[model samples]
Target: MTFEMLFVFGLLAVTIALFISDRLRMDLVALMVVAVLAVSGIISPTQAVSGFGDPVIIMIAALFVVGEALFRTGVAATAGNWLLRVGDGSETRLLLFLLPVVALLSAFMSSTGAVALLIPVVLSMARKSGLQASRLLMPLAFAALIGGMLTLIGTPPNIIVSGQLRAAGFEAFGFFDFTAIGAVILFLGVLYLVFIARFLLPQSAIRETGNPHPTLSVFTERYPTAKQLHKLIIQPGSPLNGQTLSEAAVRSQYELTVFAVQRQGQFLSTLQPVLSQTRMQALDTLILYGRDEDVHNFCQALQLRRLGFPETEMMKLQQRFGLAEILLPPDSPLTNHTLKEGRFRENYNLSVIGVRRQGLALDTRFIDTRLAAGDTLLLAGAWEYIRALESKRELVVLETPAELQEIPVHAGKAHMALSIMLAMLMSMTLGWLPNLSAILLAALAMILTGCVTLSEAYRSLNATSLVLIAGMLPLALAMESSGALSFVVDYLIREYGNLSPILLCAGLFLMTSVLSQFISNTATTVLVAPVALMTAQTLGLNPEPFMMSVAIAASTAFATPIASPVNTLVLAPGNYRFADFAKVGIPLQILALAVTLALVPWLFPF
Candidate 1:
């Protein structure tokens, strides 16, 4: 090999090592690769950063926003809930329902985005169905991978292979050419997972699911507001100002219970619980729980100055505002940051009234407490502001109280989101618009029509996926530029030319599948598809079967979590180990190989 080719191979080796080590974020590793490639003078600076503006990268980013819109607008969850209902709380039943539905959705969008949308859904389903999360999460991810095989836009590898064919003067793949084989694999794959492979997965320690009556209900029960709660500020001149709770005897004298107390301050210590011996200082705001008449009677008895409005006015805020419950999903950006740090109120105009964690209410320090996935928040805000959160992929609004549903911020909006998604899909399938144009328009529509916000559209993207794609792209360029790709392809053809056409195809499938298990399927396809086509031409055989073999092999990225973004998304939520993926995924990879080998020759004769 030439010096440039050797240098490219050495760089590829180190990059894969870093990816496998998991010591750094994939995006950072990718940036390091880009920096090295640039400094080496292997490619122009423009080419080094060009993956940022690549049409495929843009398409992937737009697809994430579209998926988030579907999720926030409740379109995807509606489908997920339907599948859960159909599963009827049985593991076998849920698997049967979940895999096909996940696959079907993946067929239309990015498989990684599909997995992200369903991570919460599957967790919720596991809770409702009483199945182990580990049992369901792997199936969800694998099904999304299978879904990628069902359509042109399902995964990057499919698109790359089709582009290779078109670039070589052949027609690109049809939208449905992959469906027949994919459908079979999906059907059989679900059965394999539920019946055979589940034994290989270990049950993790996470509280995957439980009763829906969260910690807020406990607070509502203890405080027992008699249809009235007032934000009352104690005045300095009042009779109640200098008295402790025991001495004041507010409950005995005025029939009021102070459930919480807050004083204006600069730190997290200001908000605290009501202790009987604690004396109230001037301007201390107490949330009093009592009957409407009792509250009025107490106000008349004591010199408590009412701050903004009475309880009745609080009800009026409900006409414009509402209260709802939400749970943080895994991978929430809101986690690790307190509401103050997140600018929770300023961004959304919502107020967090209380938070629930593990069946305990946290009224005090609600804003200062850092959040975590699966923690619940009881929030109040204007209906529009609350509805706006519906598009935030990080938070899953569990239920909107029927009382809040009186105002109609949600009216006809779900249908609009669905219609927009359908239009985008039809445009791509029918070749009415370029995939990039259709996706960009769909993302703008999501923003213009209020499905998601401009800020959220930016948030929906995974920087790791984008940067990884951008960084790895140069490797492909380097290989091609240095004549390394041709060298490898020629070497393979020379060594294997004596073998029969079918054996050569199988060898291509094996090489591609093994590489994909370690690297990106899209990158693997980019490198392998050209070689497969060239080998077919040299053998005087039809290129379709060989090219199809390459495509199929590239997607058999099941044997490792690092193989696909879809797989990595489930890593923490499922509490899976490295061996967990290999134990189950390796068998599926072999099965896929057998299926591809048995099916490709018959489907398109050589």
Candidate 2:
């Protein structure tokens, strides 16, 4: 290989390694790669930064704000609720409804944005319905991928391919050009998940057998034959006041089993055998399970309640509308404050339900455990109060709603967003506006409409992706400019020279698929488009077919999280391991590849 080729290849290798490792943030890594390329003189400063001005990148950023606006307006949440209601308990029905919805939304918005908006909704639904989250997340990711393939703005890959095609002297793809093939692939993909995936996919939610708590086991051990039951009351002055059964009891109290507790307006646990002499105070509740009613009664005598739920409209409203969770940030004002002194509920309208420390759940007397940094408080109150808490310098609300009021005023600028997008697509497809100008206009509209504010529009844009594209575009240009692409094309034609055009298209499709899994889809398209162009030139074949192959390959990145942001978003919430993706994604990949390889050449003949 020539020194330039070797250097380009090495840069690609480093980029791949950094992406896979994920030790640094992706944008940071992308920036570093740009710097290295510029320093190596592979690309100029203008080229290195030119990607920042790319229309595709701008559209992606604007779309993020639009998606966020939808989320903030409760539109996405409302849709999620409706979908869940329709889904009910049937997996097939859920898939049937979800796949199309995700795909459609992703086509207009972003796959990452679509997945992020859906994940929490899905997780909440899963927990409520007692279904495994793993079962739903993979489908969500796959659906986003399928949806993104449907439109030019659906994913970055589509835009990249369109830009490359424009550079190669062919008409760029229209907004809906890929829809037919994409729809077919999407339908087949959803069908595979609905009818076939259940049997092939493993039950990934296996919990650890047996309790991990030694102290809790003490009661069971002592009452080996005693059928133990124990009880405790929230005494008016005792440390057990205002705590739930699940959060109380750190170390074991003899052989007593605290089976259940009752609090204001709620039963903490269901189904407990009634015990005699079960007296509860206005502020006190019971936590008892023991064979000997006498022993249970004895244990209740030692507790006291320190406070009572105040009788006030504000308190009642606070109870009704607010949900609170303590975020243990390294620098929180409440870190050292006790519940009473902190005035957590009185001042902030937040009621602490439980504390999570190092994964252990605690609900003891408010003052029993000192609040520490990194302890997650589970609070319950109004959503507004939770939002207000987030504004506090010290507290973070993890589950605050994306409210419409928070949406930038320009969010209603969907009309402008769509118009600009259509104009860009048409310009490229008709060979009127250059790819760069088309994208720049679309981005300008986004800013003008306030769909994305000037600051947000600029901030949300991925400099790394822009830099990667710009720096790599020149290398791709150099390869073409220096006749390297032609040389490679000649070699390929000589080796597979006798193979039909159909097979060549298939090869390109498969190669793009594999490269996409390990690199940015934009990078893959930029790298491969030149070679496809050269091949078309040498064979006197229609370049459209070859370019289409690259487009399909660039987008069919379902096998790994590193391949797509949508997949990564769902990983933690779905509680999915890496293997879960391979299980479902592999089949989808094969299906998409098979369809693309067979269909591309037919649609645009060589």
Candidate 3:
């Protein structure tokens, strides 16, 4: 290899390392790669930023806006409610309903968007039904992935490959061109998950599915010391503001123990004397602990009737558990403190249900893992105890039905967003419009119709993905430009040139599949698409089959969370070990490869 080749190769390796390390945002990594290429003279400055103007990049950005509109309007959430109602509390019923629900949603919506909308509902149902969360979450994630494969706009990789194919002078894929093969794979994939994988799937995967409605009577019977009580949030300017527990004379006057105080979003543990130094503030939430008689007395004394306590009518004996969310702050004392060290249960008297960090839900083992800033913890305990902890600064409560209901939704905007997306897909598939123009128009429509505000739309775009696609596009171009792709193609053909096209396609498929498991699928596709094109050129065969194989292989990330965002989203929620993917995914990967190899040639006819 020439020195230039080695330098280019080294730069590519470093860029990939940084991307996977996630020490920097992906967009930054992409820009850095472009900078390195320019600085090293491998590509020009103009070329470095050229991908920003690429049509594929533009389309992705627009689609992001469209997706945000769906989310903003709660259409996705509304659709998910159906599945939530069906799953209610049965694991078997949930799996049966969720698989198809997620699949249908993913076929049109973004996988990440679809999964995000469903996760909360799934958790809620799991709690109600007393089912394991692990059993349902993986299926939810897998279904999204499988569904994405069925349509042109299902996932980014499919669109990227289609653009690359068009750029290489072949026809772009229609909205449903790959549906036949993708549908079969989707069916088989869902079946494998429902029947076989569930058995092999780990029990820990379902750890967060706690019973939402635990019978307090049963709990009192078992642990008679456990008291049932109401926790009150003292809104700012409330009657209780600016009063100390001692000065307020809660115990003497109201006959209630001031178990905890949440003032200014910080929880003060009355168990420690130092806590007495802190004064009450506006918006302080008080966790008053006492027997049922004292709770009534405390409420009467404070003139605070209607504490919104879960009553017998609202509380199913099976469905009366409390839910609280806590976020680990950067300077929290709990940071780096394990559950054992933090005396979590002893200190708070709550069971940690789940954790969310950086938009991913974490497993129960997270208690053993050191808490970090930005980590959100979902905990289950008595209503009083949870309210007390909610006052602490270390944890942020994410679920407040009133707050959720307050989020703005533009119902009409959802229809416009949906229309724009359809138009883009139709224009691109029918050859009447360039993919770039169609996408750009769609993005404009979203903004114009107020489906997504301009600022929100811009914020939703995955800048890293765009940068990565743009930055890598040149390097991929350079390989073809420099005859490097042909060199690789020459080497492969010489070694396996005499092999049947089917075997050659199989080899290419396997290579792309393995590469995707380690690197970004877009990166894998950009790097391999050129070689597939060159290999087909060298073999004097149609390139369509080769390209189709690469597209399928790149998107089928079955083995690792790091392999795809969808996988990462489920990591904490499902409590999946890295090996979990291998167990379920390895077989799926084989099945996908088998299906792709069998169908691609027959459909595209290389």
- Best prediction by TM-score: 1
lDDT of 2 by residue, 170-265 (tens): 889999988888999989989998888887665777343553222212222322321222234454665444443323432234323332235556
For residue 463, what is the lDDT in candidate 3? 56
> How should the candidates be ordered by TM-score, best one leading?
1, 2, 3
Give TM per candidate: 0.63, 0.53, 0.53
Which candidate number maximizes lDDT? 1
- Number of clashing residue pairs, candidate 3: 20
Reference-based TM-score, model 2: 0.53
lDDT of 3 at 426: 68
Judge candidate 2 against the unseen true structure and give its global Cα lDDT, from 0 to 1.
0.60
Candidate 2, after superposition: displacement of residue 312 in Å?
28
Q: Please list the residue runs of candidate 2 whose C-alpha ends up more than 4 Å from where it truly belongs after superposition.
A: 21-28, 49-53, 89-93, 106-141, 148-180, 193-320, 323-381, 385-490, 515-550, 559-586, 599-606
Return whichever of 2 and 3 wins on TM-score.
Answer: 2
lDDT of each: 0.72, 0.60, 0.64
